[model samples]
Target: MAHHRVADGKNSLRRRGVSRGLVFMLLAVLLVASGVVVWFQVGDHVGREGDAAAATCVEGPATVAIIADPDIAEGLSAIAKSYAETRPVIRDHCITIAVRPGDAKITLDGLTGNWDPQANGQYPAAWIPQSSVWAADLVTAKPSVVDGTPESLVTSPVVLATSPELGAQLTGKLDWAQLPTLARRDDSLTEFGLRGWGSLRMAMPTGAQSDASALAAQAVAMRITRTTGVLTAADASSKGVAAGIGALTEAAPRSPDGTPVGAATAIADAADAADAKAAPIHAVPITEQRLFQLTKADTTAKLAEVLPSGPTPLADYPFLKLTGDQVPEYAATAVADFFRFAEEPDHLAVLTALGFRGAAPMPPKTATVTFPVTPNPMASPETAAVVDINRLVFGPTS
Candidate 1:
């Protein structure tokens, strides 16, 4: 009986040891499974971190293409070049800007088609044009092209630029009301002069009329002719036109091209000679802002801005982006940054220096004045005619 009880106790001890061993194996399996799960989770987190770093580091330089009239281009390019030197921010990324000059309409037209994801003809990050009206047309055509509404960075008024002597005789000081009286005559002053308006006074001569300068002058002349009873260029030559022509002749010398020489070179040369002449001819330089860094000294000494007697047409410059299948990530970033930066006081001051009025918070309504309708080169002829007719009558200089 004693032997049997000892054997039974030994059997019980062996069963307990087997159960404990099984429990230890199960615990080991569970620990190994938990370690595998933890390893995957940590690996995923590290992979995501690496991807984010690559995205941020791999971005290329940001560039902007500006389409502007030559006059505005000169000023805008200078500003953009200066801005690029500083390397501004775009989505926490450093940006590099490029400015290309061309007709505003033609430049926007080229933005259509397939864009390579990398390299040549890829896509412009941003576009700045001479007129805000052009920007509106672009947005209307393809609303999705740009990320947001176009913004204006600057404002400039179209003015009649004339030789110093002729400028002096026309209004004593430049005045818009007197313009109608100046466009009536058939005299040499009203004729298209090849050498420009400076030829009327042989004392201070300057060269030919620039295409742009001539167009602007014609627009002004047309506005005045429309206001008075003069219809054709011939009607402008009548005796009634004589008084007007005489006034213009007094202020400006007529060129052989039947236009006044208002080119920058001509104006600068005329200004340089103003001090030596018996009658100091002053260039009739007109702009909205009374102050400009380039013209401030001249304003204080020889230059003057002729404020319109009535409401005048205001020029609005627009920045735009063209449509594409996939919007560039960097383009959106650069545009947002530029708009924000342009609105600041310091930046506005730079615009002011360049003969632009800082963009106002409130834009004037389309119906405010009857003169100077914004031209949309892309518009249908019928639509263009309507705009031109409405614009032909009222602005300071059409």
Candidate 2:
């Protein structure tokens, strides 16, 4: 009886030891699983923290103000939006750009003299006028205003825009020299078999709003003087040039409401009108970029572009960073960063898409372009000369 009781006690002790071993093993497994979970959670948090630190803007959200020419403002605005989306960091500052349209003359006045921030919006960090002529004027008026050599972001030739039918009819028959006579003629379109069109009507750009009219006037002065080199101020004010420009101004079209039509697209839009005599604008001087955009908007756009046989002025959109004692270093850095992005092949595509001749711009498929790529030697295109010619063409600046 004693041996049996001893055997039972030994078996109970062994069972207890076995149970303890099983518990230790289970606890070990649980500890390892918890450790793995903690490690993964900590790693994820660190990774997220690293990313946040990189993206976090530490210094600033700097706004670079750009005073763009009205014509180029829309394109620049688009690029600026893209730039913001990328969260560009310039000089340790998160950067963005703002584009505002400022008339070349008015903006120059404000720039050279005093900038009424209330009237002119923000004090500009950069300025893009329709032509380098404005930059030259800036240099002449205030040599210290411009920081560096102004470079052209895009180039657009001023072309004659008309309906496809009328442009085709006038082909080989028209020249810039003959334009004044055509404007003054009694029956302008009859010779071309365009009978319904009475006298030649046009939307001559003369206001200081855009550089198109000024360029056209410069072309007129160039032809009248018969000079191919850079036009002098005296050459632009020749009597013959004034008379020639005067004739075209007299031919300005009147809308059905008897309001004077000065829009370059008036002639092109007239072609799509249901009425034959709706907007009887025979022709107008316009930038190729404007024409390209106008046609791109409408699938069934009906227009033709004609390049003059003679030299035509170019709208070289100049990018100028303003300089003065008050200009900030960070602003200049921001402008340069934006300009660098703009010069990239991808960004240049944006300008090309907008219709300016930038980064290998192609011809528009919508309009029939006679001379899409080439140009003759320009004349009298200097700012002062252009200003003189503008005076003759558009009259004195208001």
Candidate 3:
């Protein structure tokens, strides 16, 4: 009886041991399965870092290429150098920035290979185009080109920069209403005709090509309740526009050599040109951060800026990151990092120094305005239209 009981106990112990072993094996399998799912879900994140490391890990400096417009190249370059200062040390990656300047439309055409991203393939890590309207074209062309969204870094206005005297004669205030009066007053008088701003010694052509000329034409049409003929290159070069700005300039003060004094310089020159109380000859110097820099640097203080009254059309500068199959994941990461650096306060200061208006004062969320419907470059006939003065001065469709 004692022997039979001992045998039973041993059997019970063996059964319990087997059950525990099975549970342990089941737990191990579950852990392995969980790890696999995590790997797949987080794969893109790890892959991006790996790609950045491989591309920028060479013994020499890493290259960050920037394709931008010529007007802002100097300032953009300065900002890039400032970004490279700490980014490389922090990320263990060396950065080299290269800038290429051209019209935004031309730049985009080169990227998508006929406005089709699927066909053209990806090229640069980043592109900072001059106009938001142009950036809108890219977003319409390939919705996913720039991190799947559009981003603008700075804002500036396309203003009719004029001498201070021109600003005063128009309205005592530099508003749109002053344009037609300036235009009509200087009509048909070739020698400092109303079209030329009074031959104010300087010969800045008053035609559509001039920012002020387009503003005048638009203002006149808006005031008269007519659809101003689209600001075509022809209209800009037309005698009407030229004669108007010419007349305005005629009232302007000029140097001994007959060169028109710039707005800031005109102010200082006005002090010398006439009694101290007289207003100086002012150029509607387009109000831009760059203009401010120029005014500070000019010893004569000839250029002066006329701030807009309301709802002025401002230039929007966009910094875009291009992504597609051809562009490696690592390149995208580096490009993204560079963009973040650009938004830093110190970096923005550099941009401001270079005449770029910083993206502040406006709400942070307002950096980019979105469209309800994404434009289809292939479907839209307007995509292929060549950029001309009329399109630029007026509107894309106008």
Candidate 4:
């Protein structure tokens, strides 16, 4: 009996010891797994933070951000690409530039009031708007942020264009003043073999609202107030002036309900349309550069140009430098370097090839079309403000 009791006590002691061993083994395995998990988690966090730090630690001259009008974006982009390859070094630091195309109004809006770099995408170290008119309007409305006078990179005059077939039927160079009277005459449409929609459809840009259209409006206002050389409040209020301007609006070629079509594309489409019944866009007010592009693109659709008389509004592509904190320390010098590079005769030649009138005298063929070398004529900011109001009351609803 004593031996049986002793054996039972020994078995119970061994069983308890084995159970404790298994518990310790399980705890050890769990502790090791937890340590590995903690190590990986810590490592991943550090890695991500390190990547973030590296991303923002770019050294050397800051990359220049150039925002430009879409009309000249392609040409500017090409110029930028060429500049990047050359890698012009400024102040012993290599400089780089990035170009983006945006709407002129949107870019102008972005440039206004305590310009925020991040909100404006990147600080516009340089801005090349379609015309100096926009820059002038901006400067007149708000104090300019431009470091100095905006450099005119290229120039183009506003011109009238029509398809070859339609142009052939029109009488001698049409005067800008005659446009309103002609718009009211239906007989002129019949003279061109155009009837109904195909008749003498005239297209003008949306005045005040669109830069191009506003320019056209300024041209009209110039004709209205040429003796004074500036549009005045009285001129805007004049019944005859208002009537003429209204006639321009009434004559614009649009959809059935008068929705404005894209000025260039509409003209091109009219020229290319297969159906003879499709009303051809008889005449459109556009820039000579644009006319050149359309004619160059389609051999079948030969667009002829009629230069506007008087002090015509020219598209002087201005290079504006952003001032204040919006611009980096190195940007101005780099911009100066770029300007120097661009002004070189060779670079000017390249710009001319892209359908711009460069700084240097162009070839004879390009010179045939006259544009003022030093045009001072532009609608005043106050005049533009009034025009905006008038357009709302007198222009198309669309």
Tell me, by lDDT, which candidate is best: 2
Model 2 C-alpha lDDT per residue in residues 1-398, reported as the tens digit of each score: 45644556655665435577899999999999999999999999999986666567567677879988776898889889988998887656677799988877788898888888888887888999987656766776787988888787778888777777777787667767777877789876687787766666766754454466667767777777887788887787778877888888877664333212245456555644323467667777777777676666565647778777788778888889887755678788888788888888777777777677777556556635433655584643666776676566556544
Q: What are the models' TM-scores? A: 0.47, 0.74, 0.51, 0.67
lDDT of 3 by residue, 1-398 (tens): 45644556655665435577899999999999999999987997899878677566554455656777565667677877776665553244466665656555456676655444344333577787655545656666666666655466665554444444443343224444354344344332232323433323322322221333233333332323322333333444445544444444444333233222244344444544322235333344332543454455454435334443423434456677777764556567777777787787766666655555565332111111111111211111122221222243334431
Please give the ranking of all candidate structures by lDDT, highest first, separated by commas: 2, 4, 3, 1
lDDT of 4 at 13: 60
- What residue pairs clash in candidate 2, if any at all? 231-380
Q: Choose the strongest candidate by TM-score.
A: 2
RMSD list, candidates in order: 12.5, 10.9, 11.1, 20.5
* TM-score of candidate 1 against the unseen true structure: 0.47
lDDT of 4 by residue, 1-398 (tens): 45644556655665435577899999999999999999999999999987565444435455877888766777666766778788566544567777788766667777675555566688777888877656765665565577787887787767666555556555355555666666777555554455443335666654322454446555666576553455666665667667776777677665332212254555556634323346445566666665565556453544555654555666778888767775767787777777777777766776676667776655333321333343444534353544443453335322
- What 10-residue stretch in candidate 3 is worst by lDDT? 365-374
* lDDT per residue (tens digit) for residues 1-398 in model 1: 45644556655665435577899999999999999999999999999987676556445555644345444556556666667766665554566555555554444455543334343344565666554434544554455666665666775554444343444444334334354343333343433332233223321122221222222332344344453322344433434444443344354543333322332224445534433243233333233332133244453223333333322434456666544544466656665665565576765665655556664332221211111332311111122222232222111111
How many residue-pair clashes does candidate 1 contain?
29
After superposing candidate 1, which stretches have Cα over 4 Å from the reference? 1-94, 105-123, 133-149, 163-181, 186-304, 325-329, 359-398
